[model samples]
Target: MTATDDKTVVREYFNATGFDRWQRIYGDGEVNKVQLDIRKGHQQTVDTLMGWLEADGNLAGLSCCDAGCGVGSLTIPLAQAGAQVYASDISAKMVEEARQRAEVALEGKNLPTFEVKDLEELAGRYHTVICLDVLIHYPQDKVQGMISHLGSLAESRLIMSFAPKTLFYSALKKVGEFFPGPSKTTRAYLHREADIVKALEAEGWRIERRTLTKTQFYFSRMLEAVKDQ
Candidate 1:
């Protein structure tokens, strides 16, 4: 599918059923075993990313863009940690939900600016750009352009996560196709790590840190990339 076509599908899904499903997974709520596992796995990724960010020193006054800041999961924490955060997502519902959550979490304090924006529409430079678990929506053919666009917007670092393509994971994903669930509603694309690294290198970035989070139902390869000096 074309980039526009891909964006439309993502916006539609997250604005509807995807919003509800992820809200539950990211929230402190009752969920099925699979979803609970997914929640744990996602939190691990977020924690790993936070560690990498904080290790660079104080987040105070740092500018950040949470490229797919679904429901303020990372946005709220970053704001609380004193980062100037601008968060965006393709789903209006997700953005609205994140805004509401941020309002409550920040208690009228430092709150992130939230926008409903497709990744391609994002502009301006930031100290760091984070796009987590969002790349699963993009196929290999379109990944390079997206990576370059994101890289251009980050003055210092770009952190991203994607479903890893491998024989084991690919087999698992194929098996998942047989089960009836939300997984069937929209296409999920897995990407090779080497391809991701190549894309980052092409944009003049180098991997600084990396981690893999996996569970029975969730998998993500998260990495931090720094601008090559």
Candidate 2:
């Protein structure tokens, strides 16, 4: 599919029940293997980001933008971590859900501003910008551009996660695509770590840390990159 077609599929997939179901998995505290594995991987990535953010300096006054802030998972925590957060998502439904969750999580105080925006459309720079798990929806060619855009938005740091490319993992994903299940998703793209780093470097960023999480059903490479002044 073309980039536009992939974007449409991603928009529709997250707008439907599939999105809600994933939210439930993220919220339900992992009742099944898929949920359990995904939760394990997702939490690890979030923790890695948070750790890097804190290590960078005080979080209380820094501005953070969470691109593809799914259901307020990272957005809520980032706000709670004492950062001013601006959260956006390509899916309208996701932005709405994230706004609602942030309201509830913050006890009716909306600390993190929420909006429906895509990576390509996100504007403004912050001390740090994070785009997690969202890269799986982008093809290889597009991933680099998105990474560059994200890099440009961060004055100091950019944290992101992607399904890492490896022959074995790619083969597994391809084989699994043949059989559809309840949580079946739109086409996912796996990217090489080197390619992502090169994209970041092109935008004047350097990786400070890297973390990988792998489970029976989940996998991701989390990188914390700091921009060069």
Candidate 3:
């Protein structure tokens, strides 16, 4: 698909289902298997991110940019932890919902900067740049550019996650598409780990840590890379 098509598909898909994901996260609704699987996967990602952020030290005084921060999963929590956060997503509705959620979730804190923006539109450097579960939207050919762009926005650490490319994982995602109802699926890309590493390395970032988070029906390869001084 062309870039425009990819954007349209992703925006539409998230616009429709992003709230469902949010509600499921808060135990607000009954979720189907696909939604439940995604929720489970994201929970792992958020927990992992929090641990990494704690290890990075001094959360109350750090700068963070959470690109593709769907419904404030990571954004609100980061802001609550006392970091100044700039958060963005491709879906306008998602951004709005995130703002609303943050207003309620972070009542006493300075709200995170939330905007509807594509990956390329995000600007500025931060102590840490975290983009989780969003790389699955980009195909292989575009992954490096995304990685490089995100890496450039990080002064210290960059954390990202992608649906991993493996014989079983690739086939699993494909089979998932077939099993989900027509309205329940969107374009999903599985990326090679080697290529992601190469992209970060070229940008003068080295992987500090990596892990594979596997839930019942979801798989994500999460990496934390630090810009080499």
Candidate 4:
């Protein structure tokens, strides 16, 4: 499907049942074994990224963008860390949830600007731009364009996470596609790490850090890239 087509599917899914399903998974709520594992894996990705940011310097006054921020999982922490965060998601419902959650999580602290926008529509330069777990919906061809767009908005850093394509995971994904579930409404795309790196390099960014988070059902490759100076 085209990027626009994928965006439609993603927006529709997230604006409806996708919001409910993810809110539960990202929250301290009851979930099945697979979901619980996914939650853990997702948290590990956030924590790892947070650690890397903290090591760079104090987050105070640092400008960042949480592209496709859902329920403010990373947005909340970034705000609490005193970063100036602008979080956006394709789904209005997800953006609303993220704003509400940020309000409660920040406790009168400054809230990040939340907007309903697709990745292509995102504008402005940030010290760091993060697009986490949001690229699974688009194929590699579309993802290359997305990487370039997002890279242009980051002055110094860009972080992204996607389902990594491997022989084992590719087979598993194909098998999973045969059985559709409530949360499987959108197409999930797996990307080769080398391909992603090449795309980033093409945009004048170089990978600085990389890690993989995996569980029984969840797998993501998290990468941090900085402008090649």
Query: Predicted candidate 4: what Cα RMSD to the true structure?
Result: 1.6
Whose TM-score is higher: candidate 2's or candidate 3's? Answer: 2
Better of 2 and 4 by lDDT: 4
lDDT of 2 at 211: 89
TM-score for candidate 2: 0.93
Question: Could you arrange the candidates by lDDT from highest to lowest?
Answer: 4, 1, 2, 3
Tell me, by lDDT, which candidate is best: 4
For residues 1-229, what per-residue lDDT tens digits would candidate 2 score against the true structure? Answer: 8999888888888899768777776775537666666777788788777877777679987899999998888899888878999999888988888888888888865479888877899999898898899888898899778887888788888888999999978888888832235666688788999999998888888888898988777889998888667
* 1 or 2, greater by lDDT: 1
Among residues 3 or more apart in sequence or in different chains, the pairs in candidate 2 whose N, CA or C atoms overlap within 3 Å are: none
**Model 4, range 80-191, lDDT digits (tens) per residue?**
9899999999999989988988888888788899999989899999999999998888899888899999988998999999999999999888878322355768888889
Model 2 per-residue lDDT at 109: 57
Q: Residue 198 of model 1: what lDDT?
A: 97
**Clashing residue pair totals per candidate (backbone < 3 A):** 0, 0, 0, 0
Error of 4 at 82 (Å): 0.7
TM-score of 4: 0.96
What lDDT does each candidate get? 0.88, 0.83, 0.82, 0.89
